[model samples]
Target: MWNPHAYLAFADERGRPYFDLLSRVGADAPRRVADLGCGPGNLTATLAQRWPQARIEALDSSPEMVLAARDRGIDANVGDVGDWVPKPDTDVVISNATLHWVPDHPRLLIRWAEQLPARSWIAMQVPGNFDAPSHRTVGELARRDRWAERLRDFRFRESPVKGPLEYADLLADAGCAVDAWETTYVHVLTGEDPVLNWIAGTALRPVRSRLTRAEWEEFRTELIPLLDTAYPRRKDGMTFFPFRRIFVVAQVN
Candidate 1:
């Protein structure tokens, strides 16, 4: 139900933060790599370009996204991240802005740490803005308003996330050499209802899926007023929506 095309519009906005998260790979040369949740494969293609000698495979659960990625000539496939495991002797596993979707990710991280080769890297970034107002507004409106009668269970989708320390500790416990940090990214999104537009492509999918088209429109309409107030329009007619994201890089030691 997540409109992958609409999400692509904000991909450029998310690029810088995700790239910064990946810098931990440093100058280490990797022979092969995999990109989890490689939406449209734009960034996945960069992995191929950076390590032209490396075998790069991009995977996502969305068939639409997989097709888009394949059309770009990247090796793309549809797969569930929760069920994905590292290939033996794989050199690098790079996941940008995708880890938050999988529930109980600390355990997943520990599992991946155990599977990846010694000296190889596991790098990931996850949106950490679940407690922010942009998200809070959605959850509040979903439960407090008239729509609450029917969509009572439509709550904030739980993400498997922890503070930077939590991730570092998990990796350290697993005998990984770990690096972790958080970043606040102010994504400058164009047009009205920028925050709504951003979530429409991602988090709002579950809510959208539960409602009729008219009900969805009504929900969107009701939600926009709240977001506009929460995230005021800039002088340039764009909205600068701040997003906090967690980054972790662990190398099997």
Candidate 2:
């Protein structure tokens, strides 16, 4: 139940890392490009613009997201990234801000690297802010006595994403030339409870999906103050959110 509109709330801020990752791809004219977990396809459309002659295909696990992507005239389908296999001629594989959601994504990366044609490119970006105050607050709140039992099985506290070096090493070991780096973007956001709104589109989805409507409302109510305190609005009425993300671009040998 991914809210495409909510996910696109800070499209400009969310898009920067993808463009940065793409800039390092160095693929001038790929024959085919696959955007795994391609969200609403707005960014996937850019791949088409960059290589108009190439076939741009996208896949997202969320049907809601795929529908929104299809609205943009993208060849977007509903499929899980873990189940996706690159075509033999697949020239570029882009997994922007999506790998962290897939368990054991390191293996997936290695498999893609092994399966792609020689000299093919794989570009991926994942959030690296699991230890940040925003996520810390969410973990803290989820552990409180009032909600602890209900969310006992919730694993949002544990980060599945690895560091840049780890990805670089893994891909390098898989016979790919890897370029990996990290960036912390300070995004100045406005509007009410912007951080909550931001995570509602992503990190909060699991909680929301598991809880009833009333319980979800109650949970959000409890979370609002915590997020507000963690990311207090400045005198200028803007909240500054520092988001860290890791990027890896590998050229398969």
Candidate 3:
């Protein structure tokens, strides 16, 4: 039950990394482009604009998100990234802010590298801020006695995302020319409980899905103050949140 509107709440901030990753792709006139985890198709529309001749296809596991993408005139389908296989003509594959959710994405990258056509491009970005205060606070609360048993199987703190070097090495070993980097963007956000509102779109989805409506509300009530404390509003009514992300762009052999 993904909420497309909630996910797009901070679209500007969330879309920056995707643009940064795309700039490094260096794909010219790709015949086919695929956007894995293309939420709401807003950013995926940019891909079409960049290469109008290329066929743009997108996939997301959430039906709601896929519906939203289709409503935006994107060729989107409900599918999981882990099971997706690139077609022979696919020249560009972009997975932005999505791989963190796939635990075995390293293997998938290597497989894609092997399967893609020669000179094809694969670009991806994942959040590297799982250890930051926003996530740490959630993990601490989920581990408490009151919530521990229910959240025992959920992963709140640990991130499946690898470091930049790790991804570079893996892709390089798979016969790709890899460019990997990390960026920490300090976003100045305004409004009450802005941090909470931000996570509600992403990091908090699993927690919310696992808890009852009343339980989710209670958890949110407890989380609001902690997030506020961690990301306090300054005199100008702004909250400075430093988010870290890892980017990798590989040209497959």
Q: List, residue by residue over 104-132, the lDDT tens digit for candidate 3.
A: 99999999999999999999999999999
Please identify model 3 stretches exceeding 4 Å from their true place: none
Across 1-253, the per-residue lDDT of candidate 2 in tens digits comes to: 9899999998999999999999999888899999999999889999988999998889999999999999999989999899999987799999999999899999999999989999999999999999999889988988999888888887788888999999999999999999999999999999999999999999888778878899899999999999999999999999999999999999998
Clashes of 1: 0
Question: Could you list the CA RMSD of all candidates, in the order they appear?
Answer: 1.6, 0.8, 0.7
Clashing pairs in model 1, backbone N/Cα/C closer than 3 A: none
Which lDDT tens digits does candidate 1 get at residues 111-156? Answer: 8888888888889888888888888888888887577876777757
TM values, all candidates? 0.94, 0.98, 0.99
- Name the TM-score of candidate 1: 0.94
Per-residue error (Å), model 3, residue 202: 0.6
For model 2, where is the 10-residue window of minimal lDDT? 146-155
Candidate 2 local lDDT, residue 244: 96
**Which residue runs of candidate 2 sit more than 4 Å off their true CA positions?**
none
RMSD of 3: 0.7
Cα RMSD for predicted model 1 = 1.6
